[model samples]
Target: MKTMVQIVDYAERGQSLYIQLAVTDGETEKRISGEVRFLGELLYGELVHDKKSPLSEQARMDTIAYLKAHFGR
Candidate 1:
């Protein structure tokens, strides 16, 4: 399946950055909300998926790659 990811919202709250994403794979569309927490020079993202829509692993990986490229990280 061809996956597509769109960033719906991005915001910085304190030491963490929050991102809202829309992920689609032609057949299904899901919402993924993530928080990127900064720890010194390192950062990690925790993603929450929409149970109703359900997300594929490929779609999730694509979303993460999109976010990395979007931030130029």
Candidate 2:
């Protein structure tokens, strides 16, 4: 990674996991919405979807399986 301006802060308490994340080259900030579950135990991943997502449940499962096959699990 090249030199870039950065900003980071955090807070933890209560019964929920609330996090804010972002990455940038100082001019543009590309941020994605994320939800953390069972904090302190694991950090799971998710694919974004609107109220309507074309991919079926099985399609999603197969795609994840393929990723695990090529990448480390």
Candidate 3:
């Protein structure tokens, strides 16, 4: 599925960032807002778990890929 990702907010947190993202795949949409901490060249974080974000594991990974493409180390 083709997905779209947009950065809604970017908050600085020392060496990391707390980001708010809007992720969509035409029909379904989700809000992925969380803090991302990088270790060396790797980024680790989780998507916000709530009723509004009924996304599958694959969807969440895709969203992360998009986020990384835009704002990764």
Candidate 4:
């Protein structure tokens, strides 16, 4: 099943960058809203059991692009 990820919002706390996402499996969609944490090149994310989506992958890639374009990381 394919997944879609949408960034809802984000926040920064100390050394951690957090993001909230609305994810769906293209069918039987659930709010299943969750957050992810980014630290340097490492990223940690929460996923609902059996609700697998490409949240971590997209978040990492997108965040990297964001940093490179905006912050020149």
Candidate 5:
């Protein structure tokens, strides 16, 4: 599976950011939105589907890795 992330909104000058996470595997794709807090080197957040279902562990980890790689400082 391949994952991509897009920033939808930001608050507090980078203290927090809202993002859309998209994952694609072959012909299937899934998307979710979540808020992430960036405090120094710590990054954490919760991702939920449109129907409020919890994301799979792999999806969550992939999203976090993408965010950290692109957005972390």
Candidate 6:
């Protein structure tokens, strides 16, 4: 068995962080996935979790306000 994985790139935008990664097992295969992460809000960033939660109008507005104030960007 082999193992190797590392973050190739990342970008920060307010309350969101976009991440790119390169993963390999030192064999003959590679995998990749992209995702957005919200600070202090795991469910808000997760695909499965977010879908279960409520992304209501109020929730979106609140998130905007939070990101603007916390990240100042």
**Predicted model with the maximum lDDT:** 3
Q: How would you encode candidate 4's per-residue C-alpha lDDT over 30-62 as one tens digit per residue?
A: 445777666655556545222454344544354
List candidate 2 segments past 4 Å from native.
1-54
Which 10 successive residues of model 6 have the least lDDT summed?
41-50
Please give the RMSD of candidate 6 to the true structure.
12.1
TM-score of each: 0.56, 0.29, 0.57, 0.50, 0.56, 0.36
Better of 2 and 3 by TM-score: 3
Instruction: Give the runs in model 4 whose Cα sits over 4 Å from its true position.
Output: 27-31, 48-73
Residue 20 shift from truth in candidate 6, angstroms: 0.7
Task: Report the number of clashing residue pairs per model.
Answer: 0, 0, 0, 0, 0, 0
Give the C-alpha lDDT of model 1: 0.57
The total of clashing pairs for model 3 equals 0
Off by over 4 Å in 5: 11-28, 48-53
Candidate 3 least-lDDT 10 residues: 45-54
Model 3 alpha-carbon miss at residue 8, Å: 0.4
- Per-residue alpha-carbon lDDT of model 6 for 1-73, expressed as tens digits? 2333444576777766654534333333434233335554432333114354233334434444444354344
How many residue pairs clash in model 5? Answer: 0
Q: Write the per-residue lDDT of candidate 1 for residues 1-73, one digit (tens) a residue.
A: 4777777777776655666666665446544444444333344554423333355666656665667667655
Off by over 4 Å in 3: 26-53
Q: Model 1 reaches what TM-score against the true structure?
A: 0.56
Computed on alpha carbons, the lDDT of every model, listed in order, comes to 0.57, 0.33, 0.59, 0.54, 0.56, 0.42
Give the alpha carbon lDDT tens digit for every residue of 1-73 in model 3. Answer: 5566667777766776666666664345544444444444566555533333455656666776776667755
- Looking at model 5, the pairs that clash are none
